[model samples]
Target: MSMARTVSDTRLIFGRYLRQTLRSKVAVVFGLTQPLLYLLLFGPLLTRLGGVRGFGSGDAWQVFVPGVLVQLALFGAAFVGFGLIGDLRSGVVERLRVTPVSRTALLLGRVLRDTVVLVAQAVVLLGAAFALGLRAPAAGVAVGLLFVVGLAVSVASLSYVLAMRTRSEDAFAPLLSAVTLPLMLLSGILLPMGLAPGWLDAVSRCTPFRYVVDAARAAFRGDYATAAVGEGALVTVVLLVVSVALGARRFRAENA
Candidate 1:
């Protein structure tokens, strides 16, 4: 019964978040529009450029869709901590501190909420990619979800780290951009390793984004990149652990 109640409550909270978010019509459109534009406008454009030799394809656009979608899905991670920031500024966090609710759940709910948002973005953008001639077989859906969750967990964990330490939205802008940009470039969204310069490719390989992209692309092609998948998962776990620990420590210090 307690488990059932927890699920019910989580659902309600999640639903409330969805409704409130959708009500912000401008924000909804803005969040989803740019990704679609990139897919529609640049998908074919990049394809024509020819893929890098190492990437194993002449169709660069075809090679790009899965990785790009996952990369873009991380977009929402920047704002994932905004709710906590609001709660802090408004003193709601203080009220919750005295409550019986789970601390893990508080963070988990936000992470899950952002996951839904980011995954929805991933689907729409990927669907557009498919419409533009990027093929993803039916079975790809299962792997797609795995890729999405991996991206979401890493992203939300980052947001938690930021929120626990930084209170201002404006203060978040530079940091958020810094976090997302390098990942985007290094992840092979626009330029895969084959196309990248030697030094750059070496750096890119060190990033988990490269692994996620490689794994996601392989899944789409019906050949899993098992090594990349394992590496991405490993990095994601490490990042999540570090972020959670930092957030917890900072949360305690600030409250004290």
Candidate 2:
């Protein structure tokens, strides 16, 4: 009964948030601009380095598109906390606190909405990539999207938790920048870490995003059984579990 209630509540909250997102067609289109720019501008340059070692195992499109997808998930979902902070300021969260909604549903619903948006943006990005010459197998692209979903859920949940803690965009924005910038650089989301110096490469291995990027790239190249895929899947699952748990706990505590 509790599980059913949570599912029902999650669907209700997801519908509410998803409806609000649909109302802003401009926001949806603009969200793709950054990744699309990377695909259009930075992507062509990668073609020049097609033969470069450590650029990964496929054409420039394969390597570059996967990295751009990861970047989309990282930058896109990481900023979602700004909306939550807005809600907090406008008393939206406070109003929800008095409702009988399940706390887990509250977090899951928002996360689901985020995951849906990210997936749609990803499809658009992939369509553009195809037009520009990307040609990965259908199954591989599907698997890569699974990674994106995991990434979206993990990052959005944590963003919400962080927003609730800081409860101020002033504090949240700077802190997020500090964290995301390093993660982006170290995770090899632009170029492969293989191109990095040995010590730098070793350090990148310590970051979970690095493994996920490697896995997504590997999937894009049709290398599904590789160690990189396993590691990325494991890291994504662990991160997803931990972040969702933390977000739900924080929501309950805040509303309790």
> Each candidate's root-mean-square deviation in Å?
3.0, 1.1
* Cα lDDT of model 2 by residue, 158-198, tens digit: 89999998999999999999999999999998899989999
TM-scores of the models, in the order given: 0.85, 0.97
Candidate 2 backbone clash number: 0
Q: lDDT per prediction?
A: 0.69, 0.91
Off by over 4 Å in 1: 1-12, 240-256
Most accurate candidate by lDDT: 2
Predicted model with the maximum TM-score: 2
Q: How far does residue 111 in candidate 2 sit from its true spot (Å)?
A: 0.3
Task: Name every residue pair that clashes in candidate 1.
Answer: none
> What's the alpha carbon RMSD for model 2?
1.1
